[model samples]
Target: MRTIVITGGTDGMGAALARHYLGAGDRVVVVGRSRAKFDALLTSATAARAEFIAADLSSVADGRRVVEHLRAGHERIDALVLAASFVRQRRHVTAEGHEASWVLFFVSKFVFVTGLAAQFGAAERPVVVNTAVPGARADAIDFDDLEMSEKFTFARSNAQQRRANELLGILAAEANPDLAYVTWGPARIVRSSFAGDVGTAMKVGAAVLGKLLGQRPDAAVRPVIGIIDAPSPGRAAFRGAKRRPLTIGAHDDKDAARLAAAVEDGR
Candidate 1:
């Protein structure tokens, strides 16, 4: 059986994907921040095929620890699913001294995938799937203020992080042609705690929109599975379950190189 690693697998789409992979008879390793939640998730029969690791990915150290643990335990990883993410109402800095949202959504993911590059290379068919919205294609990466110290807004930060995911995927694909990197955007909002920290108005509005347009958990996860199982490499964002071209803002090769350098330096 193939081995699949999923971060933030205790709840939401991550949990759903974990269950789906378990049902398909794959060995699944779920990484999350809560031991209680992991225990609760393991109560099912399919839990036999699953393992859990707890880490607060908002810290780069914790992210590296997870990658180290995986490297020590597994010979190869068939799929690495970077699905850990959350939206906060305001900016919060973690003990690692970086903005919490950026750490979890972008920094930690970059570290994990790059750290485990060797294992991925050893696999028969390795794939990395990042679950992030492909926000405005014109969104540019702020090199001087990646942590959003200058000005922070939930919308701007989220969009920037999403854009970073797409650009990172492109760069990663170029660096490791043997590995398939796929960035996926949700087709519609699903009922989850993702927006629990937002203001009341946004919560209400999200609820209404979800009720009107949200796809069921199973339906939403199908495209993710398709991306993982795709025959060819996926180097762009997938929206509405189809591949779409990415638009990197004014940043060119120099910008991408700078971003890569930053990620390496941060690690």
Candidate 2:
């Protein structure tokens, strides 16, 4: 059975993915901050095949701790599913002194995929599924203000994070020639717990969007599973089931390297 490591596996699309893999009898390890939520995900039938690591992924320390824990326990990881990111409507700095969204959304994935490289090398067919909506916004990353200490709007913050992830897939795939990297987002809205986490007005708007254009998590996760089961060459991005041509900002090696250096330097 394939071993899948999923972050944010207690809720929404992440939870849906955890359930899917467990139901398929694959060994699953989930990383999340909440013990209660992790407990809630474990049913008697699936409990034996699943594991959880409690991590506040916003902290750089917690991210490293998770990497160390996974390395200690897992010898071969077939897939690393990065579904951990929070919706911070307000500008908040994490305890690690980094911007809340930036750390969880980009840096945490960086730590996991990069730190677990040896484990991935052990597997015959290794892949990293980064669930951030890549190519959703072509907004350039602000190197001067990676933390967004200047003008912090929710849109700009998420945009930069997503763009950075695109670069992440680009660079990571190039670095690990054997590994397949896929960045996927539902072109249609997904009515997951994400809507509930936002502000009241945005929540209502999300609800309406859900009613009009959103899909359930189960439906949205199908394409991702398909790609994982059958590996793709190099790296790719998908908006829903349709694959996006990576001719856009995804192939900018200069920018990708810049982002990688920043993350390594703890930007």
Candidate 3:
């Protein structure tokens, strides 16, 4: 059985994907910030080969620690799924002095991929998938002030971080050609806690929109399941349950290189 490591597996799309993978008899590792939720997930999953790691993936140090912990435990990882990103009400910083959402959604993912590339090498042909939205492709990245302390617009931050995920995937794909890097649109999950941190206005807006068009947990797992088992043609975003390709955005070689440099510079 191939080993799959999924972040943010305590709830939402992550948990749904975990359930799907476990049902398929794969060895699954669920990583998140909640022990109680993790335990509950395991209890519900009841996978003989499932494991959980309680981690605050919002810190670079924690990301590093997770890799060390995994190295001590496993020989190889077949897939790494980043399903832990969220939208916050306001700008918050982690103990590691990073923008919390950016750290979880972008930085932590970059570190994980980098660490895996270093440890496992290109021979493993691991798959890396990051969940992003349409917001990412239509925005610009703010490298000067990552926290957006001066320009703390929620919409702007959300879009920028989403773009960061794309850049991360593209750069990682370029660096390790043997690997399959994917960024997909989960297409607004109704059960996700995405708008939990936002104001009442957005919360109500999201609630109404979610009720109208958002897919259920089971409905949303189809694309992710395809990513885990099926072969995608190239670097493109999967739209809905059919796993149909959608032309979202292209990664500029220069921009990808710049993002790679910026991530290293941040270290």
In order, candidate lDDTs are: 0.80, 0.84, 0.73
The residue ranges of model 3 lying beyond 4 angstroms of the native Cα positions read 43-47, 118-125, 134-139, 193-195, 241-251
Scored by lDDT, the top model is 2
Residue 98 shift from truth in candidate 3, angstroms: 2.0
TM agreement with the true structure for every prediction: 0.92, 0.93, 0.86
Q: What are the per-residue Cα lDDT tens digits for candidate 3 across 38-134?
A: 6766645465788888787778788879988887788788888888866787988777777787777778887888777743442355787777663
The sequence of per-residue lDDT tens digits that candidate 1 reaches over residues 132-186 is 7765556456788888987888878888787777777767666678888877877
> Which pairs of residues collide in candidate 2?
none
Residue pairs with colliding backbones in model 3 are none
Candidate 1's C-alpha runs over 4 A off are 43-45, 248-251
> Model 1 reaches what TM-score against the true structure?
0.92
In model 3, where is the ten-residue run with the lowest total lDDT?
242-251
Question: How far in Å is the alpha carbon of 178 misplaced in model 1?
Answer: 1.8
Name the TM-score of candidate 3: 0.86
Lowest lDDT 10-mer window, candidate 2?
190-199
Query: How does candidate 2 score on lDDT?
Result: 0.84
lDDT of 2 by residue, 1-267 (tens): 889999989887888889899999999999987778888878899999999999888898899999999999999999988988677888888777898888988888888988888888888899998988767555568988999999999888888888888778767776678899988887688877662246788878877988788889889898888888898757888887899866375447888888888989988
